[model samples]
Target chain A: MSEESDETLLKRLAAGEERAARFLLARYLPRVLALAQRMLGSRSEAEDVAQEVFLRIWKQAARWQPGGARFSTWVHRVTSNLCIDRLRVRKSAPLEDAALIADPAPGAESRVAEAEQSARVAAALQSLPERQRLALILVHYQELGNRETAEIMDCTVEAVEALLTRARKGLKDLLLKDAAFDAPVKAVSGERQ
Target chain B: MSAAGLDEQRLSELLAAYGADAARWPEEEAGALAGHPDLKSKIAKERALDEMLNAFKVEAPDAALSARILAARPGREMRHGTGVWRALMSALWPEGPVWVPMGTCAAALLFGLYIGASGALTAMSSDPQTETALLSLAMADSVLEENWDE
Candidate 1:
């Protein structure tokens, strides 16, 4: 039933109930995918990460004991750790390989501008140190409370707050610089016109 | 300056971390910073950044992705049976052919029926040599005495 808790669903899942797995996938797959997508910035990689995350969950369901970390928190923690590991691997990848992960295509003129802005924001987010990026993503994008974000990150609440402060400041500076550069280009085009 | 009595420095920290939305702030701190004329400009700045961050919207996962993830679950095949007997069979022996267990049960039943119908136990008990062999196996001593009086 829709009212069933995650723990109950997991117990059913351990008993090999297909419906429970479907329910869990319906509830968490999108959120998990979004978290992975935001962290990895590549849809394919995000999908791989999501697959691994669910695989872990399926394996863990049989052994999962209640009264420990909440299921959602554990999911977030798993996703965060996997993303961080992938990011570490990406760090060793070639720069040209990094450019191969393309952004989504733009449609209309306004859409193009919006897509570019979104790309810039995503790039700024990726540029942040992993912890700061994760902290921001968990709290800002994932809409988790600071306490939960702290739990996911395995840090103190104060540490999460500090990471977020730096993350926001860093993101702001990057976007502001981008806007400043765009201004000069617009001014130059105006002068030519 | 606010209802919660938050100082300017603390308010700035909250704004930088949680942005302009009071809903996102801690319960004790939410709405305490709103409507403060002095903090309006500060809130406006954080709001601008939040708007930029909000632009990076991730699309929902496609059906193919969900299918792939679902396929990775363990014991997926075990969930397919609807019949109680079929489920019991699968639980009893998850792998190999169904005929394997069926044949085993059939062999056991036939052997049991054969033993019952043949009166094998009574025949074995009446034979003196069989009894003597059985008693020797059961007893620790090898010495046997013949009953000449019988």
Candidate 2:
């Protein structure tokens, strides 16, 4: 049930209660998928990572000790580590091979503008260094505390803060540049109209 | 530090790291930064960036992906109360109660003991000279050609 804690659900899962696995997947799959998508910038790869993460959960559920990190934190840690490993392998591949953000279905003008903005933001995020990007994702997007983010990154809180500081500054600069680039294109389009 | 005590530099650092939302800041420090006079300009700048970042929305995983993930879960055999030992037991004797195999083992042990005891008693009841000859023959390194013929 939604009222049950994650640890309890894990215990139930270990007991072979199918509902517990479903509950956990519903609660965490979205977040895990999103984190991987942001980290890898590809939906298919993110899905692969999500499947792997859940498989590990199923394998570890029986052995999971409740006294250490919270279940949610451990899930994030697993997902983050898996993404990092894939990114390392991807480093050797051509940058252009990374999938572009899929465009949202067409709708109102405002929706279109929002999607464009979202794409640009995603691109800017992808441009950041791995650690900085992870810090931002864990803190800003994932809504984890600096301390928890530090644990996931295997670094101190101070280091997380440092990474966040630089991440924000760098993101701001990238968005500003993107805006500047968009200005000329928009101006030309406006003139044609 | 108190709200009034929070300096501009520290506030700026917190804003940059945690964004314009005071709620996202460290619990101990959030109260100090909230409603502070110096936060007006800096908060506005960070809020703009936050708004921009918020534009990047990630949709929930589709049903297909969720199904795929759920399908990959460890099988029922691996669950508690049905581990490797249980699996092995099931493989060795797939049907009937556990007591069946156990009873079979017990029966075999008793049968072997009965045979040994009966054989020993029969040999003891034999003529004394013949019993001695049998004992000597059993201890010999090799049976002679005459014994084999017998």
Model 1, position A93, has a per-residue lDDT of: 88
Q: Per-residue alpha-carbon lDDT of model 1 for A1-193, expressed as tens digits?
A: 2679999999988877666887888898888988987788787888899999999999999999999999999999999999989988887985322222425767778798778777777777766777888888888888998888888988898998888887877777766544422211111011100
Q: Pick the candidate with the highest lDDT.
A: 2
Give each model a TM-score. Answer: 0.72, 0.72
Docking class of 2: acceptable
Please, what are the lDDT tens digits per residue for candidate 2 over residues B34-106?
6677567667767878989888888788899877777577674443236677666546653323556779999
Q: Cα lDDT for residue B8, model 2?
A: 77
Q: Candidate 1, A77: how far from true, in Å?
A: 0.2
Give the poorly placed runs of model 1, Cα more than 4 Å off.
Answer: A96-102, A107-110, A177-193, B1-3, B79-150
